[model samples]
Target: MVRRWQPPWRRWSVRNRLMAMTAIPLAYLFFTFLWYAYHSRLSEVREELAERGPLVAKVLADSSEFSVIARRHDDLKPTINGLLRTDPSIHRIDVLDAQRRELVAAAARAPGGTAELRYYEAPILKRLMWVAMLGPDGKPYQKDRPAASGVTVETIGYVRVTMSPSALLLKQTRRFYVELLVGSLGLLACVLLAWQLAKGLDASLQASMQALREADAEKRRLIGKVNTAVEDERKSIALEIHDELNATLIAVRLEGQRIADLSPEGEVRDKAQSIIKLALGLYNSGRSLVRRLRPEVLDMLGLEGAVEELVRHYDSARSGCRFDLQARGDFSRLEGDIAISAYRIVQEALSNIVKHARATQASLSLALEQGELRIRIADNGRGFDAALASAGIGLVGMRERVYALNGSIALETSPEAGTLISIAMPIR
Candidate 1:
């Protein structure tokens, strides 16, 4: 047999499951969105760095071109200050010749020493080459940019520019706060949506479970009604057969006896006796059938008496098997479905023992204690597996009958250890 599947999450109630479904998606999306934002910031910084290289190179080339060509030491400081006054971003500047000799330099010594420096170099272009390849902003020359021509010049030296990016780093820090604010807002939105969805899902599941529970209760009620109706019909049939049919059979038997007594002592007399014997056998069979249908002894003797009679009947009928019946409390008032269901349960169990158990001894108990009816039927026979008993139609009928009375049944069985069937019924 294939075992049933039990998922780990099934341990959680519907509410928790809904919460998880709601929260997990929002959490995933929040992290993923923040991750994308972080990478975007990195990419922006990289692009800014790329653009900075060209800007620094252009600044050096423009500021130092005339100074390097004329070899004027006095003009270098003014040129460097002019560059510094235009942009607060620059923290250091250096001008170098083609021979790598420093022509002029400026440094800002902060309390924390020099910030990390980035390097840039540009060659002083001849006047024609400058107009062709260099743009005014010191970017690569483009057709749309302004470049002056007709100036005579040549490559005098290379100008190097060094700059610190502390200001840019601080700007990025401010941007991080803005990014955090945006992320917080997005997370709040996601949480609100997720909570609403989770509540809706939980409500839906609760409604479904409620509907299913009502349906199940209704089904059990219907089954109990059907079982009671069938039982009533059986009782009627048994009464009809017992009262009318048995009387007719008895009358026929009495007539046969009369014929046997009147006839002469010969083959005719023997035939009459044979007819009487057959009629007697049929009467016995009809009595047994009536008992099977609905034992009249039940109504006459009460539950305890009926149970004792049943055990005695079984003990006499079956070979190599003993049936024991024990009881306590006043069972005379035991009536309605309770009585019928209990009697049928015992009847079916005994029939199974005779047909299948091959046991040497069996016992049945009917006790009323503390306003509850307890029934236990045990047999010392070659035991069977629980699967076999569960699959038995007889056991199934017994269970249904017991459940119709809102009772419970339990079975304890293993190979050669005998089977114990226990039942408890609420009498009040």
Candidate 2:
């Protein structure tokens, strides 16, 4: 089964393309905006954590009730243990002195100095750096050594905190990118629809133009029929005049001859001879007129026979010039209309050859080869400008006939070179 095509308007359009272009940048900007917003939100969360973290540490450290009851305030012992045990927001917390001794921390029996320092330095210190930066009042806690020389001296103690916010921001940003990409794609689809609508309009206009051309061709065909009818009528009238009037005139001339033989040496005989001469010239002129109207040989014989006859007639009639006719391959196999058109072209060509081409020899060739019928009329005569002669009615008529048969005609001529008319008609 043949599938029906959708109408042009139904197909994709330029609006779609334009929308797609805008959507790409819009998506990028949207994603960037969301990324910045998510980052700002996370940074805000982390910053709040930084400021409030120290306060939480201080409260745990200085709380007198907890220090007395838990026995944890002597060093910030209760602060570190309470923060780590309760709040999940805090990963780990450590309280250290200026001497790098662990003042308080969970998971150890006594105060940790060197061994605790080694443990915190590797994992705990690295984690805390992201969650907070030390304030001016907070002491510089040496991560590796308890008392390395050349370090800042005017310090007391510090509380360290560690948290995870990078993973949190990444999860939120991924959601925003997905949403932004989807929205951009939706916008692109809308634009595509609009563009397709506009393209449909252009396609319809082209269809209308094609219809108009077809209508014009039909009109031309009708016009051609009318023209052929008028030509047929004129030819019929010319033939009637030649046959009817000329036959009667010939009969009268014969009767005049009989009377002139009986009365020789009289004015009657002289007048009779003059009348006969006049009648003969009139008959000759009538014959020429009939031939000009249409060659009878074209009707009596087919194209090939008529063309050969015309060549022979021209050879005798115009003895000053030589006309050669050659045929190769099957000329008889050509379509009737094509053959007739070819013959007319040759007739007009020879006429021009005699009239303008001041040459002594002209040749006509007709052949068929490789599915194309070829006709060539060439002369060894002074050639004229091809461009100028193209405007001539004879050449134009030849072109029209050739065009009707889906064939082509070309004139090959230069000033010194002879004129050559070549026609190629596709036969298969």
lDDT of 1 by residue, 1-428 (tens): 24579998988978778778877887888788778877777566556755776687786687666667778867888767776666444666667676768778775544112546566678866464324566656677566765665666666676666555565656776887798788889888877877777777888888999999888677767877997888889888888888898888889889989999999999988998998888889889988888888878888887877888888889999578998888989987776778877888888899999998889999988899777799999999988898777799999888877766677889999888899999988886
User: Candidate 2 lDDT, tens digit per residue, 120-231?
Assistant: 1211121112323343557664566343233322334445554434333455567757766776676567557656765665577568768988876765465445445645
lDDT for model 2 comes to 0.66
Residue 29 in model 1: lDDT: 81
Q: Distance from true position, residue 54, model 2, in Å?
A: 69
| Candidate topping TM-score | 1
Full-model lDDT, candidate 1: 0.79
Query: Which residue pairs in candidate 1 collide?
Result: none
TM-score of 2: 0.48
